[model samples]
Target: MSDTLLKPHPLDEATYLRSLGPGRLAGRTSAAYWNMAGPFGGTTAAILLRAVMEHPDRRGRPVAQTVNFCAAVAEGEFEVLVRLVRDGRSTQHWLVELVQGDVVAATASTVTGPSRETWSHRPGAPPPMPPSQALAPLPTEGRNAWLGRYEFRFERGEPIPGRASAEAPAPALSRAWVRDAPPRPLDYVALAALADTFVVKILQVRGDIPPVATVSMTTYFLADEAEMARQGEDYLLCTADARAFKHGFNDQTAELWSAGGELLAVSNQVVWFKG
Candidate 1:
């Protein structure tokens, strides 16, 4: 891992939240900036969730979040405003806005829970690959920022040729092994930040032109950090659909797994392609 990746101190929920007070409205950028691709939708969402989890009322439960990217935000100082949409004994809903100047760059809705049904099911797992054989070495330098903090090995497919070529067809699917560099166990917030890593691969396989920038991502945390770390490995399987459409938008679904093959979370996003 590079020294820059190791620079930011790991923060628990409380400390991270406290850092965002009045004087600290502008947020910290992640090491994965280059891999962020389009507008920082995932970063905006992650920051908002960090704020929500930092609130006094949060009880360290699973949170289901839906975020919409309304506009692009340049990397730098920004503000997040969180509102309590509803609070109940078992669940809470919050609305968050990511702001830069007068613009609402992104908006999100979050639902935190204390109770939910036990029954669970997920789509079929991706084909298995051994951790020892599959782990890709981390790149010494990255085209985008986030690549520095992670060691990523693509298990399937390749990056589309050229940066702006929309003429190429999207691949059907892609898989990758991802681990944090200098390997520290990450809490839900940190893991959520990593989950945004899925977008680049999804777009790589989704269309010939690869305009699949993330519009929003919704994640549900299913287990604790210790459990996630215990699993030994993390794999991301991204599949996209070109069919579902609304208001000129399309949706793609992604599933994440621990090394033990347990389902970690599911993400769905709306993407708009540039013509």
Candidate 2:
């Protein structure tokens, strides 16, 4: 990715109509851009949110998003269309569709809102780990890669370097700091996308082969800019847990924190893997 900062504009009817042309996926094929698993649900959400955030009208704000994967997107040209469902003073709703040759590969709905006081709560923050402890760098080389578009530093158990790992006991807990390319300040939407990074740590803990892939993820924002910015760096401490299991599925929960141990967001993702 380029070091240039990206400022997105709102998706008006005119821009949406013109965006029907070929879309770029980090300079790669849109389909293969984020095929972490066979399904690109989380990737779809990331792309859609990035596009929506670029919109001139709703560039900086908290947004709630839900996406449904309809079909697999293969490598090639594609387009995204955004529709304004409702635009209110405090909140706005948008619908986005990913299309390839007239095929609807994926779709998403997002809601953006300003901070308002309805209720509040303070929960105990996750235990801290010294940043000076043995930390593993993210694997960025070879095929079947792990961390691609993000930079990370493990604060706990050693992450199996490269794409392959010798089967061993999975750790009960792990912590890591995550950030995107160029390490600029990211908004809530981008933070939500980064929250999914813990899925790798969770699967590693479970000793699951082929690494489990996320089916769905939901994140709740818990802090304001002043709180987030106070962390010093755009980095966030992510801690994950694989608490329960059933017929071929597992539940994982992760919390995002600032370097000062301030909780910024919490996330839960349903993951499944093939034997």
Q: Which consecutive 10 residues in model 1 have the weakest lDDT in total?
A: 9-18
Error of 2 at 73 (Å): 3.2
Quickly count the clashes in candidate 1.
16
Error of 2 at 191 (Å): 1.3
Compared to the true structure, candidate 2 yields what TM-score?
Answer: 0.72
What 10-residue stretch in candidate 2 is worst by lDDT?
8-17
- Per-residue C-alpha lDDT of model 2 across residues 50-146, encoded as one tens digit per residue: 6566665673355466655566666555577776678898788877777777688767677777766678776686676656335666776652332
**lDDT for position 32 in model 2:** 25
Taking all chains together, the TM-score of candidate 1 against the true structure is 0.76
Candidate 2 versus truth, CA RMSD in Å, comes to 5.8
Report the C-alpha displacement of residue 83, candidate 2, in angstroms: 2.5
User: Can you tell me which runs of candidate 1 are displaced by over 4 Å?
Assistant: 1-26, 30-40, 115-126, 138-142, 162-170, 199-203, 206-212, 232-248
